[model samples]
Target chain A: MHVSFQVQAGDFSNAGKVSSTVKGILKQLNLGPAHIKRIIVALYEAEVNVVAHSYGGTITCEVEPESVDIMVCDTGPGIPDLDLAMTEGWSTATPEVREMGFGAGMGLANIRKNTDRLAIDTGEDKPTRIHMCFDLADGATHA
Target chain B: MTLRDVVQIVDGTVLCGDDNLGREVHLGFASDLMSDVLTLLADDILLITGLSNNQAIRTAEMSDILQILFVRNKRPTKTMLDLAKEHGITIITTPYSMFRSSGLLFSKGLQPVY
Candidate 1:
């Protein structure tokens, strides 16, 4: 089964809703605990990015017996420097978002650490798309 | 350590899912950064933090944490409690500072999540 959603910026009230829904679906699909955890973590980081940066965006998840693939896309200020953006402890999130317990510059790194395969494509203020896959066996992806 | 032990150490008031106090937690993460908690391997974890936002509950719920400890007597509002209830997570309030509450847990053999 595949799941997708639109994530909106500054929509704190419903920020995590997409991730929660994906969690329920993954649980119902009988995905293993480790795999499910990876999916949820990646989903959350993507969702948080949309809320904190983009005006709003879409999240799509493709689930197979072997793996789960997720894509989070948004029309926000695209990463000026993808390398820096991918670094741990780097963040461009505003103070308000930080106060809400997010924007620690850990979103992409956390997603990479949790998922098995990650690919990113972005252009400033254009659409930024992050593609991540978590293997069912290990729930880890490098680079 | 278990949620019950954390509760006992902090002298915290149970806000929800008190029945789950018996659940065991393998590790604890103390942080106000939801993203930091997200970096943890989401298995049998406990969250201790001073953050009172709804995001804290949401993050814990997604991570399937066994318990939440809001230190410094920072009680969660009715909305936050409801969120915790919906996620089947136990929330406890301790008058102790965040450092003290987590310190007590560490002394009691609760491992920290890296």
Candidate 2:
């Protein structure tokens, strides 16, 4: 099964909607609870990242019998330093974003912690893309 | 501890999911940051937070946290409560600060989700 969602930047009210929808589908598929939780966590962080930092984005998920692939692509002021952005305490979120209880700089770290595999592509002048895959066979155990 | 016990311990008001007051939560995590809340690994945990926004409810929903206690008399908006109700998440509000709420729950045997 495949699903896609459009995410609007600064849409904090609608943040997590994509993750919620994907989670429902995962539940209907009878995926393990642990696996579903990890997917939701990763997808949610990515979704929020778009809402908090991007101009807009799209989230696409392809669910297979053995694994799930997720791609979040956003147009925005892309990260100039991927390594710094990956750090746990580095963020460029606005004060309003921080007041919303996000921008603690744990978004990418949380995504990294929950996915089996992750790939990020971004530059100061390019759109950001995060690709994540989770192997269903392993459930909570990431390879 | 059962959510009923949580309500009394922290002097909280049940804004939604009153029927679920008897539900038991073994662990509790307190934070205003939803990102920190997402990093928790335990199931059946209760979230105690000062954030009174929709994201708090959304965070609990995504993390599979069934109960949320808003501290410092912070009340959630009607929309936020509605979302919690839709997700079957119990929402409660307390006059106690976040620290006191967590401390009270901890004193009553609710373990921290460390």
RMSD of each: 3.2, 2.3
User: In candidate 1 chain A, what residue range of length 10 has the lowest lDDT sum?
Assistant: A134-143
Q: What is candidate 2's CA lDDT for residue B103?
A: 87
User: Which digits, one per residue and each the tens of the lDDT, describe model 2 over residues A35-122?
Assistant: 9999999999999999999999999999888899999999867999999999998999898888888999999999999999999999
Separate clash counts for every candidate: 4, 0
DockQ for model 2 equals 0.90
Q: Write the per-residue lDDT of candidate 1 for residues A1-143, one digit (tens) a residue.
A: 76678777898867798999999888888777777787898888789888988888899988877678888888867888899999988888899899889988889888888877889998666678898887776533221
- The residue pairs that clash in candidate 2, if any, are none
RMSD of 1: 3.2
List clashing residue pairs in candidate 1: A90-A105, A115-A141, A116-A140, A116-A141
Minimum summed lDDT over a 10-residue window in model 2 chain A is located at A134-143
For B58-104, candidate 1 gives per-residue lDDT tens digits of 89978878588898988788888888888888988999998998888
Alpha-carbon shift of residue B59 in model 2 (angstroms): 0.4
